[model samples]
Target: MDPTDAFFTQTVVGAPFTVLLGRRRQPGGSQAEGLHINLATGESRLSQLWQEWALLSHATPPGTARTRPGRVRRLMERHALWVAVLGLLSLTGSAVSWGLLLWK
Candidate 1:
């Protein structure tokens, strides 16, 4: 699979299981060792994650400003075009210089 597709899948998967956890709330199962081991640690991590998700989810569209990438890409494309042009010009200049030296 493409790296980008994998990245998107991972992004969604890593999103707090809590986002949909409420909808699928199952009755607590038998308290296994894993379940009881770090209740406080898990709760605090979830709490902090939820706060971050809330901030991101609630942020205004204007505040996000995602268009910077397109601008950066255009700049890079322009730079690439200039580099290509410069390479061709230098090659042509070298050819002319070689011809002049041969004529001498």
Candidate 2:
């Protein structure tokens, strides 16, 4: 088996991760498709949905998408702390809102 195919299949099949493939609109009125791999956890899916929307809205070239693993890792590392903080803040805000609503 090809190494690349083996890697993708292993990562996606029955693993704690998923590979999402879809098309996005390009700047010159064309469509660009890309692949995104994300964790299968609930919170990760929610975050990935938002990221997918943003990526689709401003589509990248096919080559860029295919070669984005390193870039994606770097970006996640850079924003990990801020992302965690925001996630905590959102959960706290939601819990507070729910408590207030139930109290009323």
Candidate 3:
């Protein structure tokens, strides 16, 4: 077997599935790579979902979706923080308004 095959195959003799996700070189440049939890079947549901999303997004108009996956992922990560901050500010403003009404 090829040397890289070892990297893709399992070393242990227990679990039926093994997953590996990382960056690797493609024909043009480096791209996301994954060895799914199931190697015998040779299919990753996660990868398929990602592929479908990529295709659907590219089919959309420019600026309608994230320009890049990494940026979009970052935005998603911070989305909750932004929402929480906004909610806190809104609540504070409402409380201040109520206090002004009480003073009047």
Winning model by lDDT: 2
Give the TM-score ranking, best first. 2, 1, 3
Q: Could you tell me how far off, in angstroms, the CA of residue 50 lies in candidate 3 after the best superposition?
A: 35
Question: Which lDDT value does model 2 have at 15?
Answer: 42
- Flag the better candidate by lDDT, 2 or 3: 2
- Score residue 104 of candidate 2 by CA lDDT: 100
Stretches of candidate 3 off by over 4 Å are 1-78
Q: Mind giving the per-residue lDDT tens digits that candidate 3 earns over 12-87?
A: 4432343322222245533454334568976655565355555675375645754566977778777978878989
lDDT of each: 0.61, 0.65, 0.61
TM-score of 2: 0.33
Give lDDT tens digits, candidate 2, residues 1-104: 89898889888874443334443334564332333345575332334445677768666655664544698789888999998999999999999999999999
Candidate 1 residue-pair clash tally: 0
Pairs that collide in candidate 2 are none
TM-score of each: 0.27, 0.33, 0.27
List clash counts for every candidate, in order.
Answer: 0, 0, 0
On residues 42-99, what C-alpha lDDT tens digit does candidate 1 reach at each position? 6423343345656676555645665445887778787997878999999999999999
Candidate 2 steric clashes: 0
